[model samples]
Target: MTHTLNQPRNSTKSSSFRVDLQGLRALAVLLVMCYHIWFSKVSGGVDIFLMLSAFFLTSSTARRISRGERPPLITGWLHRFSRLIPQAAVVIVSVVVAAWIILPSTRWLELIDQSKASLFYQQNWYLANHQVDYYAFNTSSASPLQHFWSLSVQGQIFILWPVVLAFSVLIWKLFFSRFNFAWVAGAFFSAVFIGSLAFSINITANNQQVAYFHTGARLWEFALGSLLALALPWLSTLPEKIRRIAGWAGMITIVASGAVLDVQGQFPGFMALIPTMAAALIIAAPATRAWANPSGVLSLKPLVKLGDLSYGMYLWHWPMLVFYLEVSGNQKASFLAGTLLIAASIAASWCTTRFVEKPVIAWQNNLAFPHWMPSTGLKAISQIAVVAIGLGIASLSVTAWENNVEHRRALAASQTATDNPGATAPEDWDPAPAALTLPLATELADEWQTPGNPCAGSNNPDDERIMFCEQGGNFDGSPDLVMLGDSHMQHWSAAAAAAMEESGGSWILVFHPGCRYGSDADRDEAECANFQDAAEEYVADLAPKMVLTTASKTVAAPDEYLRSPGEQETIVDHYAEAIQPFLDAGSQVIAMRDTPRYTYSIPECVDSNPSHLEACDGSAHEALAQINPVQEFLAQHDYGQQVVSLDMTGLLCPEGVCKAVIGNVSTYLDDSHLSKTFVLSAKRQFAEAFKKATGWQ
Candidate 1:
């Protein structure tokens, strides 16, 4: 199961091949499978895979080069990729088909992007750059291809490691032929290990989500394995009893690493050394070690067979689990479902290894297909051609499908706007069972005027106002409405725009992603602190007829709606402080309560639970304060007569339960933000409320 290049005809052979390594591969795959399916944990198994891959590749290549054989660079690359790509290609194709059939169309676009990333071996980069919360399955749906990140990392390393090996080969052949080549390789790998490990620690501490998928952050694990590969000969010289104890202890450490340590949250930082080092220790043990060695357990016939299927299983398991969750509407699978999924993954892995991988590897070895004349020393051109055509067709088809969906949604939105200028739906209308679609997934994106707005990221406190304005009605210049705060405030942009159009006013938007309107440092984002200060000054300067913002902010803690006592008080006090300046400037201030957040996406819930929409509904008491903190603060001590409070919770949580959908429209785009499609329907009601609160009409 350890993926490695084909040894050239003249390469040095091992005393005997290690079947124990194969067993370790099987155990690692099983650990990952179990952790993902049942434990909802990370077993650090992927670290073991990374280490073993590097160990095998480095040790094999080093021994050949040290023995003065030419590094079979061309044949090696072909063998390595051919062994991997064929099986990976099959799995990617199968996953695409399964996703198209089983997953909601809303997720198809993301799946398409992920499929391409996986196929091209850039999935880790894709996930890292996108800031995907790989661990937060409750709030964000797990991507079927998320597990491909490790495979992608390995693929990247496979390509890059060879270059380093080839460089080492050059040095050994050109200058270090008289010296021990192992030391040269060891020094190089040691440098890589130290450098990458330091970076991993720094980046993981700064941004764990990105660090989790960053290839740079994980390079040290592979480097450590390479270092171990250089020392394998010396390691084999250790006493038999010591080797046995090391192997057993290493295996035990790896098994316990997941259960006893916070591996997922802290890796691939220094903590990752636990599993990777353990794997290296096991690999360094001599194959002839006694039964006291853990290799005895690992090299059993059944485990060896499982190891043969490990690569395929690792590729196949996650998508199956994700598809099962999507189809079954379960956030987490039951024991029965998990068992069935594991069985399915194993069966698929066996078929893929037997029918797909073995044949491809054989064909590649035999050179049955002709190579392109120009791209000499590479695998048969036919393999690359087939993969490219397959991936290109799939990517374009999905892109076209997404474009068509977007075109239809845009047409629908335009028609809806024309037909209902006020954007109101019927009172008794309910969400259609099949209403959820791909367009609705990012429906809120168009609701904000921030994209082309001049006000975006305006941090200057003295700009003489009127930078980014979302004008709702024809204005000679005077502003009648202003929207301020973070995304929570921006969520109501559509409704506020509609209200402005109806009430005859120009509205200004001033917001950043995590910025609050108030100047309190504790409650606001440090990065956006200056922007908030500028926004406060700008709002006071404009003194629009009415200022609209939100009192809602997500607490820093998980599953906790109520902020810490100090944060809550600071937020409440800041709200008054924020509005006091606006009130003094004769602008009526209206602070709306934030909508309840849910643990899942509305569309995902609707897709999975078509017959039970109520399953998506959440308790207000759990997701929100019993009473609005702003409303309570205002009631206990009046901020000012000019400051008005609006509770539009009735629009969101009409029956004391925040419904996923209302009036045939999906209520939320994701976990907490209201979908623009749903918000559009409430424009008329919002306009009326605005008129009542501000007496603007």
Candidate 2:
């Protein structure tokens, strides 16, 4: 089913009437490569490629349906899929091996899980969640299949378009042969297209990065392409001069989408119309122009050549760039350097297409045995089912090859010592006095929730206090410390209880899981909106000595979330007014900065690369740059001799970059928060910083 794209179908073909669009494919790929290699500051190339994909697919299918021919959708799916899988397999296997050497054991396990899902084409949703912070010019890390969100959209179209198209064909067959079902299909698709675009526009107006990677937000762009194809009959008959003008207009739109738009702009939303229309015009252009030939500007030698290998190049480029950036510590891409990398990617793709993709497909094609009959076109896909199963089994068998008693023992031992929660219990610094301990950790019991820290607090007041129990004993054993914050601060109590154990601090960790440190009257994200008044009253009654917390700085400044400066100041002051309790209590306050976010899921971080060791060697500067703006809020605070900083700057950083990885392992469990492995690595550094800032020593 995997046809040779370079070698056009010779067995049975449509006459050489016109394929002016052949040149357009070359043009689209060129735009994409240029944007990726040098001007990711712009996404014109991506827009062009997206438009072209919809145009070509819908047009090709219309031709078949127009003739009353029904080719099985599975054939095209398998063929297109086979064309890309081999190279993907190699990249994944390489990433897995690299991770084992360079990344921490926790990240390694996650990568394996993401790899299996990606292998089956489920990376789009995985990446959608990632796009929340994925395209921030300052965001670090990238998914190997981040681009595949486009493919998933296309694949979904492939399945759904047929049902819609087939139904339209039936209407044409039964109602009237001369029926223009194109208009009907166009109208229906256009409705969904407009509706989704409206939704995307509303959402993206608030957050463009999330809109960029979300499928629900983007489906309309592809629908625009399909609608364009359905309009081809009218377009092909337009005056030659008008067609040329439309082509020019389409080109201009694509360039504008990339060059004129900023990350803050609502994109592939209402702005998507610019490029989508442009691609359709370019594709539907007349063949009369000399520039429209495969050998001309549209299909110049370089573009046509590269376009042939575009599928492979797109598949492998991001992962390679990530690995390169990780090991070399290069964040910005130079024009010449990026071009060279793109060329290298092209070469690698060509080799993969020739040796791996072709041979495996041929083997499957030629497969025939006495037990099976070839009743299907060209080759029976069912006949090759057994071989596919065998290959799957082989892949899994290789993955499980090291399953042995000793290896199991080593894995188990590693998981317990390095991975188990209790192994890295906070060093109790009990020499300190009771009044000095933090608000959250002073009260101790056995309910501490960070998995392994043995000491925790008793949630039940009636039950005897379990204070300072994890580190052996509470030397002075009174309960007067009050810890106030989110779940993160709650987890740090083990260390706090230890610090206050001698004359045990009267500590109680009053935390709401998603609860932020910011005051009510603001809606950054409520831990539980209904509990606002009740919780604040509860805290006031407790009247703890101090308040320790961590949350988004935006919680205290909602206007900062938008472009209006005057609004930011007014809103921030109102927000701060909501949490004036601590100043009244005469309590010392400590505020931890929220952690930086990663672009990919924790698992995708591992699956995207082949070598974990190389991926693990990234810098904190590159990873944490987005949060530099956060310093602005920190500087504006009015609290005196309070508001201590628990910085991860040095702990998460190495050299000049701040990567998601730390000490040969990814540090984050999700977008921004630290994973247990990463948190422990930073604990020693955090303790020292805390002591220096608060005089807790």
Candidate 3:
């Protein structure tokens, strides 16, 4: 539930009474809470809140402008944002402090970054631009503020909507004064509604992940509500029976939207009309005493009160769920635990709304110091100024403190010698060296260097290309070697670049996230199949002497492992089929064995238990399949004697033990991929294998 906008009840001409809107707010927030905590599904409740906010905002602005009583733009903005920022700032501050106290240091940087983004209401853009998988169900470990993406969208619209209304007012006065200001504004908003809807549909189809948080993609929802605000007068004049039916239909639609629609994949698109239109119908419906009236159902006292606390409820529920998941160490809690969490969140929301939100509202209303000030605007600005300054200072202080911690770690790293240096694997060596320090792990975790990766820009999963040319590779007059596979291969790009530099060769990397070198059938998606085909064709054309790639892949489920007899044969066949084109074009294939894939984050584990590093280490047998899947595959498949299978597992997991640190270097960056620093340390061994495979000597 990315979240909402606030509005005064009498803002719209026909919405003089808004008990129904408040009830709708209650319904929307509850659906979001239920979906987030237990269902892990999208509820389209957020779309309704977004629409309602725009309706209120546009109607209020239109009323002010139509009356020729425009308040100072800055005053209006400061007042609106002041009301919004206080509770959000408190939540952010509480979350930051709580995360620091409870979460691992490895998660601190990201949490802090998001906490800051949440406060400034830019988290949606940050999440979208960073390509964060916002729907990922990492309840225990994911950022609590991830849900703020929706709130950030609403906040941005809050800032811009007024400006748009102001511009429309200027246009109406200048060229269309004869027409009603509300109607003139409606025409402009209608145009925006249609144009934004078209863009939203096109973009969501192409990249739904980014589209989910994109401001441009969501503007149509807001515009739709704004247009509805203008249409309210006519809508209220509809026959009594039709209005009652419309209200009932809207209510039922809002309740059922989550269960019926595929919101996650097709949201903010044409499908979004289900909830937004439901909300519009309800908002348009005139009040009635009849039981069939949606307004009657929504205006119940308890529901109306819940609506009053909806903003705070929305704010508190996600963080509470996340905190519950983290503290309990459970992915999904029992029904009882979820109920407790919801109860706790509701209590917290009530406290926030009653003690924090209402008081601020009262205080802003009571201000009398600025006699020149027209209304609550000055008081709101004053409150915002204080909160902004305090938050800014707090953020700077936290940043400085975190920087100091890193600085100390860097200094320690510089003074010490890396114990293992990862020179060679030994049978009897302790994976953790006495001289190896925590700083080394931090350094290694930070050093996942990749060179010439094509998915470096704004390319989302489907748009990622397979080919990436090394810097100066085309003009360096060096022999070309092509590297390919998934993240496993991409992780070794820096080391491969180093080896090529020494061998007077350059490399091109052809990689995709989960698409390793395998047959089209083994590929995860159509995009992966396309990438595999294109990469094979590209490599054949280049006619490189060697095609370097990795054969190690890890599955999250234990049942998915290739442990049975002849299981590795399937892997071999798939790999051979995928790489046959390259081999057919006279290129040698060198497949490196994968590193150990850990169950949890090695850096995070190490960070949490610095003194007991051994606890972070795992059984090598469990981490790796008994048979090297690739080696077993290659044993039977003949690509002449040119295809070389290399298992340097010994270099990484010496003596059947995969530890967090090796030779003073962090072995794995996250769970499976080798840290760039560790890989670079093993460059001598890598080069030796390369020479043997390519016959480069």
CA lDDT of each candidate?
Answer: 0.72, 0.52, 0.73
Candidate 1 lDDT tens digits, 462-560? 454323444445454447778887777777887787777665566676667656666465345555666666677777877677788886554422426
Residue 26 displacement (Å), model 1 = 1.3
Task: Give one digit per residue, the lDDT tens place, for model 3 in 1-697.
Answer: 0124333322323435566677789889889888888887789999988898888777666666667876236666666666777677777777877777677666777776787788788899888888887567784356888888888988888778878888888898899999888778888898889999999999999999899999999999999999998888888888977877787788889889888898888987889988999889888787753467787888787877787778888888888778778777788868898788778877887887778766776776666775676556566566677567546755764676478557757666565333445544454555443454443443544665666544322221233455443431432422367777777887777777778877666666667776777745456588777787777776676677778877655543255564532222224236666677878888888877766676687877776776787788876676667888776677777665678877777776668877787655567778777777678777888778767666775
TM-score of each: 0.81, 0.66, 0.83
Q: Model 3, which residues run further than 4 Å from truth?
A: 1-17, 65-68, 288-292, 370-387, 390-409, 412-415, 419-446, 449-466, 471-486, 490-513, 518-556, 560-571, 574-591, 625-645, 684-697
The best candidate in terms of TM-score: 3
Candidate with maximal lDDT: 3
Itemize residue pairs with steric clashes in candidate 1: 430-664, 431-664, 455-468
Q: Write the per-residue lDDT of candidate 2 for residues 1-697, one digit (tens) a residue.
A: 2222221222124453233344455455556556665655546455555555565566776777767787446666555555445556665665556555454343433345456556665555666564534454322444443555655555555556556666666666687667676766676678868888888898788767767766667767767777877887787798877787777776667656666766346576777767667777776776553774322355454655565666667666666665555555567567767777777777777887678666765675666655554446435464245335533643563365334323544543444232332213243422212111110111112233443233344422221211212222332332344555555555555445444443345455555565544545434554344344444454455454455555333222124355332122211223344356755655555555544344444433543452542463343443343443324555777665655555445555545544544333444454444554445444555656666755664
**Candidate 3, 695: how far from true, in Å?**
8.3
User: CA lDDT of 509 in candidate 3?
Assistant: 69
Q: Which stretches of model 2 miss by more than 4 angstroms?
A: 1-22, 98-110, 137-140, 176-178, 292-296, 360-378, 382-479, 485-491, 497-507, 511-538, 544-697
- Candidate 3 lDDT at 650 equals 71
Q: What local lDDT does model 2 show for residue 93?
A: 62
